[model samples]
Target chain A: MENFLQFNSVSYFYQTKDNEIQAVKDLTFSVNENQFASIVGPSGCGKTTILSLTAGLLTPSTGEILIGNEKVGKHDGKVGYMFQRDHLFEWRTIWQNITLGLEIQKKNKDPKKLARAEELLKKYDLYNFRNKKPRQLSGGMRQRVALIRTLMLEPQLLLLDEPFSALDFQTRLLVCDDVYDIIKREQKTALLVSHDISEALSMSDRIIVLSSRPACTKQVVDLSFEGKTPLLKREDKEFGRYFETIWRSLTNENQKTS
Target chain B: MAGILKPFGEVLPMKTKKQVNFSQAHKKYIKRLKQEKILVVFLQIFILALLLGLWELLAHFEVIDPFFFSSPSRVIKCIASLIAGGEIWMHMGISLAETVIGFIVATLLGAIIAILLWWSERARKVSQPYLVILNSLPKIALGPMIIFWVGSGFSATVVMCVLICIVITIISLLNAFTSCDQDKILLMQSMHASKFQILRKLILPNAIPEFVSVLKINVGMSWVGTVMGEYISSSAGLGYLINYGKSMLNLDLVMASIILLSILAGGMYFLVNLFEKRKQQ
Candidate 1:
């Protein structure tokens, strides 16, 4: 019930030499601790902008964004982001990629952190691949590796921006399950940005829908289902109703904008 | 006729060895062979045969002295003599030392400078244009000036090689570091990585392929700079041997020196290629 992250009337604009294009306007939201939250809406609805703002890479034009009761800027390390592309360095062995944060933080000497990294690789069945490069892995495996790389940092909240959009449908389903299990097992909270209504409905505790460009939060739904995993939940008889409701919310908003 | 069967069982490209149909496999082999060689092979064989035929023709006509033109056979004999006397090895050793030292120093200096420049956006903005301007200037024009400053010594030759090669290394690697997937950098930032941490873990590691490529380009450039420096001033080196051969009108010596230079360049090229292959693996 308590807020773990808050966006207080946040707005963003990109200023070029000629003009300023507003990306998001007066956006306000809060995510509770340990909640799996997702944002879904039309293309270019500032979904990615929201993630960037939350990560403190882009300063909000009008209002403040907070993480763990502190303004985002005051603490830069409390968030973890996974992108649309896994963006794993091709030259690094999988083990090296996962431990990159620790090495960079000079935490390689910390026995506990190093052990946790190894344990995660073993648990994920990527242990055998620890010596392989990112290119050597399949697309789904690379995404899992990317996720593990973020988890190694052990941040308070993980941000995924359409993380499985590039994957084939079959791989996407399996990866969605793998990702959810990892988040739960690690006891880490997450905020995912996706376009898949079914993905948002199935994987998230709450879905935040935004309006089109210069986006603002349009609706929020708290989802509950009678199944354990995303694939199982997709088979739930009520899945159609939930999908329809979210679909109408997105489509109706687009109609209003046009 | 194949249309009905087209969608059924296409093998993955990786499975090319085991699963094959004649038309597709034959076409693929043809495409690959065409890609691997065309102009380079033709030019190589043409150059070889033309030189030999020209030498034999000139000797037959006696239009110019064989001593000055130095028929291909005479050049080969001179090469054999140089190798037999061990003079070629000594001269080659001196040039190789200059080239290797200069190359290593240039690469390190360039990498350090690139890292420092990359760390500060303001520094990159200010210095990048000047570097471009410096690289644009012909390095050979500065050969004599370098000889004066370093007094036509070994260190001056090394400095010349470094001067020629450092710009390329810095430009290539700095580009590589900057071009690291922005998403990945953002990921690192969210993990609360420090600037130094990102450099050590993400940026530098990602830049390895590019850095290796830079070494490949610099191998030849540094050799050129070192040999040019030696030719302009040094008392010993393969370049000096060539310059002496030219003054004495000994065409066989000149040809021998050039063959020796090619071997040195080819050796360095092979070493760099090996490094690249290992990285790829």
Candidate 2:
């Protein structure tokens, strides 16, 4: 498989009034085309920074990030980001919110793109809620709406920054399955940043575990399950073994930091 | 459990056997709500009538000296005569024009300045302290200087209203623009949106509710500014009438001017509130 997104020794430093803080250091990883990859790390372990760097919102202080063998630059159109919060403009109805990117891109007049938006809404069982405001939707529905909004842009890569963390436990599990299904069905490459081991293990084709702040790759675990869906994969015989491996890797990093 | 199919294809839950009893209870709930509303209005009107009667009686008996206090009937008589003479119209019209013009100009100019500040980080940083100082300084103290600069006329009055309203507008609007969700902005950036696109699509829409609230605040601030300006230096206006009446010891005219001012201010507030409600809907 061809690597769709690559980070070559990427490092990021945040400059404050008093001192400089290194958030990411020598972080090297890659997500192949049509792959669901996740980067799991301890809290505040620069997981979000990695997503930001990949999305070209911030420049790597050292090393390079590439999408399809090209260097990532500011406001890369090939990348779509799904934030932890749905970030749906409450004032806008679901359909209007979904087309916000198209409006910004000046592609709102395109019939094809608008149809895709309509199709995604219907595909995700949100057709009935097309005219409702985001606040009127449940937590899981809002997350689905957020994903649909991102997918509307038709980017080559999707960057999800702890997209399920804001939801309740039950909603989180359901949304995780929903998102995994959507990403797989769309045949789009995805890089998820998460701290939940089960979440990453269930959805990701490969999981890259990171050390605490000044984040660097600690281990990269490739996953294979006979079950097709994330929920079904959660019940796989090897699920516990993968969980223990990722858990111990994370806990070891925590002990090292302390 | 099945539901009835409506003409519009909506599913209406079937009325259950036990639920039939709720119809009477619902009617009683609605009746109680209506009675409560009517009772509230009646009590409010009764309270106002009682207060006015007491005030009129007190003044007639010379218990509170009507010369200074001025009874409601005297105020009404003064208004009636002024209406007959038709001089109050000119004063009311001039004050209304100054206040409306000032309110509009201040809000637009302040919002524009806020946009400029939000667009540039350095501009916001440079103007932060100056804005704080200008916002805190007593604007009334600048009344004489404004008159000196713009002359003691309509221009000065309008300038006073703008001065009082603009700083608060700038501060509030700038805060609203800056405090917009950073992640939403990032989402826009991920779509490769330009700075102007982000502002137009996200920042401007996000700040609208705040702008409406600012307009509501300006309704009162504009009145204060216009009145203060007239007090400082004005040959015409409701404020001028009140000031002239004070100097002449015509308490009836002063009280009448105040009453007119209150009515106009209340009307303006009501219009703005109505506009806000429509926008919310």
Candidate 3:
């Protein structure tokens, strides 16, 4: 697999009236194609800041980020971001909401792209509820709709920002399996930021853990589960041990902060 | 389970099932009865009764002179007399026409100008201060100047409404465009979305809520603009009716005109509300 997205020694600062607050300090990482990677860190550890940088929403104060060997000077739309909130427009029906990006991009005129979007909705079991509004759907279903909407854009990279955090525990487990299955089947690369240890452990092929604020990579853990999917992986005997290791890494950082 | 909507933990198990059945049936009954709707109607009736009763008592005691205050009765009688005399329609027509013209014209111009300002960053920076000063300047104070420029009647009324509404529409829509969620915008930008794409895709649709809010605000403002214009320049319309009544010391007609204006204003307000409800749907 090719190294499709690379973050090279990136640093950022938030300049306010009084002082400058460092966000990502000399962070470096690269994700390969078809990889399911999760970035876990303490609150305000600049995990989101890193994604923003990779997505080219911010100019690095130092170092460069390369996507397919091109420096990210400005925003590139090949990144699909799923925030904690679904951000689905309530006024629009499910199908309309999903095709919103294409409509705005005027790609809806392309029959091939339109078919792909339609097929994705059908594939995801949302075709039946195509004309329904998001407010009419359950929390788990809405997140699926949101994911399909992002996938409709045919983005090269999918960024998940604690997407399952808003769901109940039971729903979270189900949606995590649903999402992980979708990402793998689609064969798309993903970078997920999450606080849930089990979720990250189950879903990710590689986990990049970060220290507290002015965040830098603390450790990178690689997992190989004999199970086929995240749900099955969660039932593996080593699940608790993986959770403990990640929890200990996180708790040790918390102690240092105090 | 959507636990926010119920608290069933406190009930005993066997009886809880019975209570759940009872509550479920009771809930259906309440929903079928349209309790919220009934409460609204009940509240409206109570308020009407209280107002009418207070007015009757006040009139009975002569605490407010009938000749001066022209109690609710006098206003109703004035409406009845105006109808019998076949002048109510004439007054209603003039006022309605002025309001409709002013509202449509102002809303169209306001929306157009807002879009224009949103399209250009330099134009926004350039026109912003002038717009702020223009918006801040009381439109009512422009009444005499407008009457001078447009020379009374329809054009003056329309101009007043435009002044009252356009600035607000521009400011509201411009703010809406800028206030779009940054994360969503980033998603678009990474796609190499064009400026037009960003505007059409991201900003415009999100701006609908703010646009609706401003439309509601514009309804009342346009009424003010039209009536104030009528007061300053017109020989017809509800404003003219009140001015004529005041000039002749016919307090009954003045009260009648105000009641008529309220009805028209309320109707416009209701129309905007209907649009909002439709948008939600």
Candidate 4:
């Protein structure tokens, strides 16, 4: 099957007054349609640069990125990005935040789009808090709201950048399950960037391990677990084995770079 | 008598002891809250009374010369006579009108100019040095030039108020606009939001707290600019009254005018506070 998203030899660099810092080099990967993929790497290993490139927030220094077989542009609406911070407009209520993209695109008045938003909010259990500001909700609920907001745009691909790293351990586990459930239930293609090996392993069907700064694709690991949710996946016997492999790949990459 | 009391208590035994205890605690909590509020009011009044009494006593004992210092009682008397004569109303109206006009116009114009600067990076770079220079210059130094340009009157006062307020508004708002979370802007960009849409949806909403702060500062600046304008040239205003009283050495009138000016400025500041409170809610 053709890839739903593709990075064709993508590379990125940050230019400064006196120096240029290569963030990613010759990185290439793809996520099949409706597949949950994750990119895991060492801290500051330019994992986020990959997401930014995919979202077309930054152009690749060389090579190209494609979504749904079409090239991505600087302001393409085909991609939805969830940042580390919830990034919900504090001044706007949950409902307003959800519809922000639609409002910008001038599709907010469409009945079908509004109904889809309402349906998503209801499905995610955020319908009741629709009128409340983002701050009033707990961290997990806020992330859910953020996810729902991005989902409202109905992007072809969702890029989650450490979406639950800000939550406490327990909340992170629950949010990971919730976010994974939403993405799967919606049958949407997703590409996640995480430093947590277990998080990447449990949530992703396929994982791309990246090397340290000037990151390149170190290895690609495909995961399958009998358990359904991320929480239950931790109990799967294969979970430990998959964790070890990804951990070793990451550490080995770190050792070589250091 | 003990048997009768026991039977009476037994008649009300349907109410649980826990319920009675909870009700008692709730009542005490409410009463304490009320008492705290009353204490705050009482302390405020007490402070004012003590300060005024000290001023009156000092003047009475000639520790501070009453002629120059003007005791609180004399200031009150002066105010009472002015009210009775009804001439102070015209001056108060003139100053209030000028200040209000200046405040509103300056705030709106400042916000628009800030938006313009934020919209264009080249424009912002070009205007940066000029804005810094203007903010640092004493606005009052432009008084003579303003009068020459606009002719001394309410318009000139408003121009002065704008001069005092607009630069600070631009600087603070530009800072706020620039400092809005870059990630949020990127999120909007990924949604294909236009620059103007991003400004409307993200930057402006993000700048609200800063905007409220700017308004609060402008309230004082507006008053300063208006009073300074009146000082330079005004036929009637509290500032004019103060200047006129000083010429005649009628310190009581000068003290009364100062008191009125403070009250008016305080009232304007309170209104801005009310706006902020509403926004927060």
Candidate 5:
């Protein structure tokens, strides 16, 4: 498969009043078409910053980011971002929240997009809650709605920025499976940023480990597990081996940084 | 005793197995709530009656001078005569108009200024200290300046009300707008939404409850402004009546005006509360 998203020696700097801090340093990686890529790193390792760059919320100070062979730009509609929090407007109903992008893009009048929104809600078992406000839903359900809201825009690539972090462990596991299933079913390329090694191992086709800030790619491990679902993948015999490899890489990075 | 009991099951019968009557319990719970509400209202009325009775009894016995303290019956009689003579209505109407106008203008002006401040970081930063100073400064101090600037008339009274309320509105609304969740704003930005779109779709909607609260506060503030303005310079209004009655040493008219002012303030507050309820729904 061709590279759908690429970052070429990307570097980013954050400017404060007194000093400039390097966030991401000389990072290079690529994820192929329809592939699920996960970036695992230590806490505060600028994993979210990298995702922000991909989403075009921030621009890299050096090198280039390419999405489908085209350079990334500010507010590019080619990418969809799912934040750590669901970030659903509490005052708006589920349907209204899902259609928020369309309204912003002035495409709400488009029947095709509206129908797709309805279909996604029904497929995800959220149709019954379409009229309900976001607060009325469970944590997992709200995340699903957040994902569906992003999907309504039909972006070429999806960026998941630790979307499951806020959830409890049980809900996290269930939501990981649900999110993984939906991404694969949609056949869209995705890059997820997470600190949870097990979570990355279960859901990713390719796992890229990163060193501490300013973050640089440490290792990229390609996996061929026996099971399709994340739960089943967790049960795979090799799951433990991959977990150990990533954890050691992470711990080594932490040691070097400290 | 055991033979007489005939075993627990035989004595009570299996059909008589204990079961909670949920409907009856629910009824009793609802009745308790109703009784509490009634008791609250009754106590409130009793407190008012007690206060009024004490005042009336004291005034009747000349323990306090009725001429100075103004007895409840005198105030009531004064209100009745004012109504019969059809004079109080004009004053009430003028005050009400000034308050309503001031309340609306102040709220809108404050909201607009807040939006402007929110739109530019430089503007917000620059104005922060000034806004703080303006908010803390006594609005009544502006009464004389407004009377001269706007000419001691209806305009002056309305201007006074606006000045009092607008500062608070701007401060509160700007706080609301600035404190909007950064993540939600980023969400909108990621979708390529314009600033206005974000404000309209997220920030404005998010600040609605704050806006309602601002309205609630403005209702009271505007009344204060109007009355203060009228006291400074006015030919008509309840404030004028109070001031005029004071000059004439007619305590009954002053007390009556005070009562009327309370009723009008209460009515405005109730309207704002209704608006809040409707928005919540």
Candidate 6:
């Protein structure tokens, strides 16, 4: 399959005032067009560093990354990032937050973009809260707003960095399903970096497991389940088997590091 | 044990009754809260009245010299006479204009300078110590020099007001702008937002609470600067009136001017507070 994004022997090192910390070691992976892929690993295992490199927020020390056959630059406007926190401006209402990117890009006056924002809010059941501040919404609702805000930009790839970790388990499940449904319905490719094995397994078409510091892909697991949505897929009879397999891979790497 | 249990027994029945008629009880609770609020306002007025009454009585009995310490009634009469003559309005109007102008200009200039400092780390580092030194210097000491530079007129008074207010506004706002959540800025950066866009969309909005706080502080500072400026050189204004009354030994006029100053400052503070409440909502 033709890759939408490719990491060609990408290695990254963060330089502090005193020492250079090797973050990623010759990492190589790719996500195909319109595919939902996840990078899962142990906590503080350079998952976010990989996302940062992919987003072109940081340059790789030794390798190159390509998006749609083009090299990623410092500010490409091609990658949309959803942080762990919603980071919605409290002063802005839902409508304002949704159009933050377009406003930054000065595309807010575009009628087509405005209509898309309105349609997304309406379709996602957040139309009623469009005029309300982000603090007024529940956790799940805020994440949905965050997703819609990202979607308004219509970037080729969505980079989510543990977007659901702040939520309670119950809300996390529901939001996972909602986000998965939205990504699928919009036909957008996504790269999620998460520590939750189940989250990665249920929401992703493929999972890229990374080792500890100086992370490189340890294993790539492709998952298929009879159920369509993430919540439904969580109940698949083989869900536990897949979970065991990913868990073993992560723990085996942890053991090697120790 | 029975004596303590008796009070508990009585409360239990009432609590159960309230639970049985929850809506009615809730309404009664709200009504009681409203009555309590009204009572508190009444008590505040009563305290003020009692204090004024005591001051009048003391002055009338010659316990305190009425000449040096004017009574509340005398102050009111003095204000009433000024109002009747229509002289108080000019002083009040000139002072109000100076204050409003100074407050707005200082706030805008200070916020812009703060944004500049936030944008350039080198500029901030270079100017920070100078700002600290300026903020610490007694601004009143600069009164004669400012009057000399700007001339002894309305502009001098406004210059004094701005001088007093601007440094603090810049410092506080810079602190707020620099301390905006780094993650949020990174999120904006990821979207290819320029520094100016981040300022408009993130930093400025994030600094609003601090901005409002600075406005509240500036309200008081601007008044002080204007009045101080008037003390140095002003042909008309409440500050000028106070200086005139003091020189002429008209304690009542001085008291009246001070009262008017407090009322105007209180009004400005109340407006800033209203802005804060609306922002919160």
List TM-score per model, in order.
Answer: 0.84, 0.94, 0.83, 0.93, 0.93, 0.89
lDDT of 6 by residue, B1-281 (tens): 23322311222111212345468878999999999999999999999999999999999998999999999989999999999999899999999999999999999999999999999999999998899999999999999898889899699999999999999999999999999888899889987899988988889989999999999999999999999999999999999999999999999999999999999999999999999999888
Give the share of true interchain contacts found in each model.
Answer: 0.44, 0.50, 0.31, 0.58, 0.54, 0.48
- Return the candidate ranking by DockQ, descending: 2, 4, 3, 1, 5, 6
Q: CAPRI verdict on model 1? A: acceptable
Docking outcome class, model 3? acceptable
User: Runs in model 5 with CA error above 4 Å?
Assistant: B1-27
Instruction: Name the lDDT of candidate 3.
Output: 0.82
lDDT of 5 at B175: 94
In the range A105-135, model 3's lDDT, one tens digit per residue, is 7788889988997898877777767887787
Task: List the candidate 1 regions with Cα displacement exceeding 4 Å.
Answer: A68-71, B1-65, B80-90, B153-156
lDDT of 2 by residue, A1-258 (tens): 587799999999999999999999999988899999999988998988898898888999999999999999986588889999999998899999999989988899999998999899877788877997887777778888999999999889999999988987867877788899999999999999888889989999999999999999999999999878888899999999999999999999888768
For model 4, residues B1-281, the per-residue Cα lDDT tens digits are: 23322311223212223544457779999899999999999999999999999999999999999999999999999999999999999999999999999999989998999999999999999999999999999999999999999999778888998899989988999999999888999888888889999999899989999999999999999999999999998888999999999999999999999999999999999999999999999
CA error at residue A76 for candidate 6, angstroms: 2.5
A58-153 per-residue lDDT for model 6 (tens digits)? 999988999999999888788899999899999999999999989888899999999999999888888877898887777777898999998888
Candidates in order: C-alpha RMSD to true structure: 5.6, 3.8, 5.5, 8.0, 8.0, 7.7
lDDT per residue as tens, model 2, B217-261: 999999999999999999999999999999999999999999999
Residue B151 displacement (Å), model 2:
1.3
Return the TM-score for chain B, candidate 6.
Answer: 0.89
Least well predicted 10-residue stretch by lDDT in candidate 3 chain A:
A70-79
Alpha-carbon shift of residue A141 in model 2 (angstroms): 1.6
| Clash pairs detected, candidate 1 | none
Which of the two, 2 or 5, has more lDDT?
5
Per-candidate DockQ values are 0.29, 0.39, 0.31, 0.32, 0.28, 0.24
By TM-score rank, best first, the candidates go 2, 5, 4, 6, 1, 3
Tens digits of lDDT, candidate 1, A129-204 = 7887777667777888999998888889899999999988877887888898889888778999998899988888
DockQ of 4: 0.32
For model 1, how does the per-residue alpha-carbon lDDT over B77-133 read when each residue is reduced to its tens digit?
898998899877878888999999999999999999999999999999999789998
DockQ-wise, the better of 2 and 3 is 2
